[model samples]
Target: MEFEMIIMNLLNYSGEARSYSMEAIQFAKDGEVEKAKKSIEEAEQKISLAHKFQTSLIHSEAQGEKLSISLLLIHAEDHLMNAITIKDMATEFVDLYVRMSKISNGGC
Candidate 1:
């Protein structure tokens, strides 16, 4: 694939992951645990796809390939990082919501 195409894929996957993570958080807030979990799973899948693209670039660079750095690449990287962070935080929020729900339901 062309470098620009790879970058665009990275951006697209990362953006989708971020959206799913946000949806997971919202679902958890709404007390829809299953839907929240499903969203988190979807986010993880997108993150995995994005990471594959990232790893391909890393492997290329390790083998003495020169990659031209561009603003779009930087933006894509930023989106991937933000998506990862949000996904992680969303997982924690989902767990917290589950616990709160249990507590409210007299589960201890």
Candidate 2:
């Protein structure tokens, strides 16, 4: 795959993962545990795909291939990082919400 295409894929997947994380948080807030979990799962898959692309770039660079660092690539990296952070936070939030719900319902 072309470098630009790889960057674009990273951006697209990262953005999608971030969006799914946001959706998961909202669902958790709304007390939709199943939906929230599903969204988190989707986000994880996207993040995994993005990671694969990132690893490919890293491997190429390690093989002495000169990969030009572009502003777009930096932006994609930022998006990927943010997506990972948000996904992790969303998982915590989901767990918190579930715990709160169980506590409120007297289920311990």
Candidate with maximal lDDT: 2
Poorest stretch of ten by lDDT in candidate 1: 1-10
Per-model RMSD to reference: 0.6, 0.7
Instruction: Look at candidate 1 and tell me the lDDT of residue 35.
Output: 100
Off by over 4 Å in 2: none
C-alpha lDDT (0 to 100) for residue 82 of candidate 1 = 100
lDDT (10s digit) by residue, model 2, range 1-108: 999999999999999999999999999999999999999999999999999999999999999999999999999999999999999999999999999999999998
Cα lDDT tens digits for candidate 1, 23-101 = 9999999999999999999999999999999999999999999999999999999999999999999999999999999
Worst 10 residues of 2 by lDDT: 99-108
